[model samples]
Target: MLNVRLSIGISKILLSAYCVLGAAYTYAQSQRVVVTGFTGTSSRVPQEVDAAGSEPVNALPSWEAKAWKGETIHNQVLLQGGTQQQQVSVTAGDLADGKGNRIPQQDLSIGWVKYVWTDEFRDGCGYRKSVDFDSSLVADRIQTGTNTMLIAAGKAQPVWVSVRVNANAVPGDYTGSIIVDNGKKITLPVKVTVLDRVLPPPSQWHYALDLWQHPAAIARVHQLPVWSEAHYKVMRPYYEMLARAGQKTITASITDEPWGHQTYDNYPSLIKWTKKKNGKWSFDYSLFDKYIAFVMDCGINQRINCYSMVPWKIAFRYHDEKLQRDTVFTGAIGTPAYNEFWSVMLRDFTRHLKKKNWFDRTAIAMDERPMEAMQSVIALLKTIDPAWKISLAGAWHPQIEKDITDYCIASEARFPDSVLIRRKAEGKNSTWYTCCSEKFPNGFTFSPPDEHVWMGWYTAATGMDGYLRWAFNSWTARPDEDSRFVTWPAGDTYQVYPGPNTSIRFEKMIEGIQDYEKIETLRKTYKATGDQVALNKLEAALNNIRISNFNQQSATEQLAPYRSLLND
Candidate 1:
């Protein structure tokens, strides 16, 4: 059944430019809806809109008012390696019918018609993480939409606008507009001012962070049976998001169940291991090849961390040819049979990586395990090939630190600061990671934006090469009920929700990464000019950046005095 409605009323043309006190502007279209330039913090747009009454809204602060035609739209700053976002709220119009009553929310038409891409800042961060933007690939017009919503008259519906100016983007004003399809032709101006600086490419990100990717969790969240083309469609945006965030490592699983949880689990295995009727081990890499290629295709071309040649529980099941049945093996790492199985697997895997030109970029990665397990696995890996790269994310293991290609230190562990600084100097990767340990500097929902933004600064300050947080899309079993699972903190499980919609924490972390780049930029300037004062100011700032806590610090306030200096 098709439903339609018709309206015939006195033609009214009303225009009012209302400016809010301070840095906000609102325009009304015949009292039907009003829009004010807004900004998104760590919270989602809906939450921001719903809480608009009690909380003060934020907008892009204009350095020069004359540059803006309307208060809501104009030049916004996007540092070369950073992300900038703006929001506008569409509210019920302030018009009255003949009966002196306001119009209903259902009458509002906030459908965005098209986006005008002008100049070099042509890329748009796709709506709600639905698609990724690559600047090399330009588009004439971008059509955007939000969920179907009916905002009541006088109530505001916030719309999100995000733009990522590429590191190589020409530094200038890129003009554009959001054209609304309402009866009134309203155009909102968009001018992105790209700065002159460069974000490191994925391969040289300097941070060897590995935020684990779980295909199974995505499948469960979207309620799809098995990984199909539909699963790929649901999954691409997430990998793309991480890639854009300057993520360097690719988390790949080898076989099913990953050596733990001998019961039902959802973690997808890339390899289908089998023993044929001829009594020889055989393997399939179809899915493994596809997923890695997919992630690389999403623009994450960097080190590949194939996880857990050894896991905690130390067990797995495989088909046996002689018995013509499935067999279970439960034992420690480097046992004869265990060594035999992994020998073939790792050798073949290395060959596969070589075929794909990922051999030097690949690492045999392992999770948290005891020192004995680490030693055994390291030994077994050496037996496979002395030159095979290895990655381990766990407690401090000094005996093996020099041998490991990448050692991801846990936040709780203490190693002499000089160890990592020296390692980084030697072109070795020294990084840090945090899981469900020490509550400080973690990315929980309740954790302040300062916590998220401080991580990158701390990494750079401590002279660590990179940082890692455990999960990308590892959603809770009952993500809908609450993202918190079992005993973990409310947001410790994941930084992003199902829609690939970012959390405030994720956004703040990106802010911190940009801050780190700014610091690097300043250091270079200081070296070239022999500016001791600039070096002194950087030292003073670092004094406030304690690893244990933010101490309620404001990242913006800390960076304010140095912004122009670094840019200069």
Candidate 2:
């Protein structure tokens, strides 16, 4: 009887312990990290509850996206050739056991989405103002650096998953998985379908994407001396990124603060000017040659645009050897001082460029100057060398249209059919540019992400050769943290971040450029095959891509049917 009682007691104790252990295991299993996928176009705020006072929802179990061979597809599963990105949100459910003990967070080994503070403005255009606007933290920056993400209980973290599809990738379906280890391994499957069509490599692209560069900003952001070896090293990745986007023109400054110190960083002259004791001017082209070679080597060999026969301030800087001091020449346009000042430089520059075999590809570039000033500058350039090229990005002036070799007018401006035809026939390049002036169809951070992509299609539809913007990396004081400036809307001064990080704006813009390339390629192919039906279909689709359509329809909606037509 005693042995029986002891056996029953032991069995009861064992059963009770078993039940407790099982319950603990079940509770632990319930506290899993939930992973959800979202479209790249949708900017999700980093909050546990949304503005609707409810938790955000996604039906996807794992992240999946599709794209073409050379396009960069965003989180929306839109297709592209270059890369496919999926925005994922990882949320930690009750991170503790039933005992209410704190559970350690897991280290997420993937790319993170950085939230930047942005404001809601009346229009996407114009300079910065003190007007009251709704402000919030926006997810824009995609940091690819290896950083561990830890999520607290009931909180979520945004992850950026990008997969690059090579230019020569075979058109088919591809599959991968993102494994998140939070004590237990949770595998998220990723699916990508590469469309049959191919996007040409950036080098083969004809789009003249001229995003004016600011090397000085790179140096400042990296805390290195301007033009230092380390600075160049840091700048290499940035320029290479531009090259990958099919950049055509090399922005070279010939005078200090060429835009009259409009940007945060001063635009220093690449060619050093010095007035000798004998009163003759000479230029040191070492920096100019190095920079041009550097950019050309990076595959931007189309045109070396030396800035300003007409700077905004009209103040030229040169070292006065006799006084052993730096001097500034305030010579107004058309003045003898101005004419003589540029005449010597132009003559010497022409000789130097010819010797380097770069004269044919170099342009005396100007930006947003008066028509009279442009006429005088063009006359001076022509007087020096009839073969000298002149590039201008400003209001359209028909009088100087013939003289401008690479003319980029404002986005609101249009060249007459005759002018476009004549310019094309004469082998001249015509493009369009957008600044803080244009509200819709601009690249401001507050602007819709699709608007950037829309600009590319608009270029093709409007029969423009390429696109131009005033600033590429003219970074603000804290570019990675804040994109706001006193002169322009947030993110107006820079397209990218300091870590050489790319933003949603930059990536989408590149996608549009790729679209432009694909369109050009398909147009030529259709022409070669004499497929008027397909050509007409493509043309009709482009015709519908007007700014009016853009306002009424989302870029995805506007581009979908047309993109499918191209794919077919």
Please report the candidate that would top TM-score against the real structure: 2
Error of 1 at 354 (Å): 3.5
Q: 372-427, model 2: which lDDT tens digit per residue?
A: 99899888988899999999999999999999999999987898989988888898
Clashing pairs in 1: 31-93, 31-94, 32-93, 33-93, 42-504, 207-466
Tens digit per residue, CA lDDT, model 1, 1-568 = 1222222221121112222322232233333344444343333222223343645545442222111110111121111100112233323232222344322233222322111111111121111111221211111111234523333444334443344443444454555444433334455554444445555544455454567777778888888866789989989998887886778888887755663642123665787778788867788889888988898888786778876767655556677878878776676576887788778777887777788788888888877778887788888878777878888888898998987888888876755778876776766788888766655667665454556666777776777777887777777665433443444545565776666665446656766676566677667868899999888878676766566433454544444454354444
**What lDDT would each prediction earn against the true structure?**
0.58, 0.76
Candidate 2 Cα misplacement greater than 4 A, ranges: 1-32, 38-49, 53-59, 62-66, 76-110, 123-133, 152-156
- Model 2 gets an lDDT of 0.76
Pick by lDDT: which candidate is best?
2
**Model 1: residues with Cα > 4 Å off, grouped in runs:** 1-144, 147-160, 166-204, 259-265, 414-417, 477-481, 549-568
In candidate 2, position 567 carries an lDDT of 56
* Model 1 vs. true fold: TM: 0.70
Candidate no. 2 TM-score: 0.86
